[model samples]
Target: MASEPPDAAAASRRDGGRPGGLRRMLRRLTASEAEIEAEELQRDVERHGCQPARQVERGQLVSVTGRLRTVVYTPRTTVPTLEADLYDGSDVVTLVWLGRRQIAGIEPGRALTARGRVAIRDDRKVIYNPYYELEAAP
Candidate 1:
């Protein structure tokens, strides 16, 4: 039998050989459903060129894309706020729109991209009055 060069062997290993298949299967078997979903969402975030919620820093202006997990309208006597939790599979960032009751299509399971400065309120990541664009339903 002929022997392959060291470089060729390395290339095959990097290009998804038997080892890669085994690793991928093991990962799928060991990872939870939520973890796998999160990974997929993270990949989508990268494809959209937006920052992941987990990596967003306080006081930094950033754009994050994710699915809305929840939408709640808090109607206070003074100020009304519409809040939605955007989950990027890595973390959640709360989006708050002030002085409003609700906006059409701002609902759970809807995907969107929001841009604003990150803030920490009650130990949770928040973006107040963010500029957001709704993603088409998938």
Candidate 2:
């Protein structure tokens, strides 16, 4: 197969940035259902004080599932966080975006299954963290 033009890959990324179609596929292939579920249990994971990894030391490494709410990509800034609204028949959870390395596409209300540990951030329950980190995207 012919290799893509040198600029071809760069062009696609330039067109959609890092959070493009490719990112979404990677997230889908990596995230787990339990991870998403654990995310739903967060207590305002967005807040810096929630501290998922620190507070929830014994978080279970589960496979969670959820739906994307939004994805903001800023190459000039730092890692992209994939904001999402995750749910599990039991309840609806607001999943905060993870680091850029783990984040992927911005599905915006799309379903996802993530794999990670249960933790807390700013007094809230979270799936991913440095210690018991949560892999929301990929």
Best by lDDT: 1
Candidate 1, superposed: residue stretches over 4 Å from native: 1-19
Shift in Å, residue 50, candidate 2: 24
Clashing pairs in 1: none
Candidate 2 weakest ten by summed lDDT: 47-56
lDDT of each: 0.92, 0.47
What C-alpha lDDT, on a 0 to 100 scale, does residue 34 get in candidate 2?
63
lDDT of 1 by residue, 41-93 (tens): 89989999999899998999999999999999999999999999999999999
Report how far residue 72 has shifted in candidate 2, in Å: 5.1
Q: Which one is best on TM-score?
A: 1
In model 2, what lDDT does residue 130 have? 21
CA deviation > 4 Å runs, candidate 2: 1-58, 70-83, 92-98, 101-104, 129-138
TM-scores, all candidates, are 0.80, 0.36
Our model 2 lands, by Cα RMSD against the true structure, at 16.8
Q: After superposition, how far is residue 53 of candidate 2 from its true place, in Å?
A: 17
